[model samples]
Target: MSAFDCIDTFITGGTAVIELNRPRQLNALNRKMVSEVVEAMESFDRNEEVQVIVLTGKGHSFSAGADIDEMAEDDPIRLELLNQFADWDRLSLIKKPIIGAVKGFVFGGGFELALCCDLLIAASGTEFSFPEVSLGVMPGAGGTQRLTKLAGRTKALQWLWTGERIPAEDALTHGVINQIVSPELLMEETLKFAAKIAKQPPLSLRLIKDSVNKAVDYPLYEGMQYERKNFYLLFASQDQKEGMNAFVEKRKPEYKGR
Candidate 1:
């Protein structure tokens, strides 16, 4: 019934969701699937109706990894020519927040996909790993860099070199994830958290996301300057005035996202 081969999308009020649909393969991410995901997120990034996005999988696993069958058949030269990682970079361009609601197996490329999100919440039993080391390769996407940024170099090397599984609790303690819940409550809690974020002024959310990303890539002084510039720019928005004036008037402010 869906137009897409690998994903199903739903827009619910201020939150949009993209659900991986390859349950039979444990939601394996093939080129088709990753392409579809980038396409959908780009559209949502441009859509004013969408305030945030929650990405999840339909079945027991978020994704086992990239499609091994597809990879096994690829010639090395052809793989380099295809350059699938270019699509993954587009995810960083999206200005809105993305919350990954992960459960079960989140392995290799799947683990990298979760790392791409602005925030992550996982079901209790979820396992995160990069088994690419055992496969005689390493993460081609931003896995090594991103994980090392958050979890630091020592832990990142330990996990990457050994191909060990990181459970939800361990991931939380190390800052790989924001929250953990029972499997049944994962989506429910994620949506609730997203809705709370959605109620804030749109421009603030956009700028905040941008500033935080700069923090990851920029030096401390430069990041602070970027943050200050965005802070000064927000005063030009209609929502900023409405928010401040409403507080003085002791009334709820209505935001037009201007």
Candidate 2:
């Protein structure tokens, strides 16, 4: 167990599950929690044994955003909270995949946290909103840019303007969530998905993720160029030859991440 009370991290089957443990406070993004999470994530990234990561929250909510009650005139407190988003930005550059299993309220920073994942799996009743506008502030995290990129300009504006929560089903329809499982099946399904990803060639997975993300931000020709570059680069790896040989041998490929 970690010395920190705000976050708990455990490793199972090569997957590091990072749980936001501040349940009583709705897993609010506080200074300690943010720092602990960032530390844990960095540790996970450095651990070669950890193949994938799943981030979730304990209790009824995934996260209710920053701890408003902790608001103070101190610059350190504000700076610490801001640093959580910085950690999230670094997550996008991680080689291993990260999956977010969101349930209950994933509002403000919580929603932005989910957006950081390569894949997002939410519970059927998950609720998402950007309520910072109502608080007379904008989303300090990647919510503004990520939301608009994920849900498009019109819908993103609608969500921000209304400050209304969207249900899991609606979020799925709008392309915000990839899958919605029952509350009881949340972790089960998420682990299953993570395991599936873990079985793939690690370098290939990273390259594919990078290519797709680049495609999202680039033009068609530029995206294709990016894909072509990655394709040839991956083909040069030993894993690529192993994958091909395994196919011919009618056996599963054993990727050494070469």
Question: Which prediction has the highest lDDT against the true structure?
Answer: 1
Query: How accurate locally, in lDDT, is each candidate?
Result: 0.93, 0.86
- C-alpha TM-score for every candidate: 0.97, 0.92
Model 1 clash tally, residue pairs: 0
Question: lDDT by residue for model 2 over 116-217, one digit each (tens)?
Answer: 787899998899999988987778768888888988999999999888998899899889889999899999999999988888888888899889999889
Query: What is candidate 1's local distance difference test score?
Result: 0.93
Residues 26-129 of candidate 1 have per-residue lDDT tens digits of 99889999999999899889899999999999999999999888888778899899998899999989999999999999999899999989999999999999
Instruction: List residue ranges in candidate 1 displaced over 4 A.
Output: none
User: What TM-score does structure 1 among the candidates reach?
Assistant: 0.97
How does residue 41 of candidate 2 score in lDDT? 79
Name the runs in model 2 displaced over 4 angstroms: 72-85
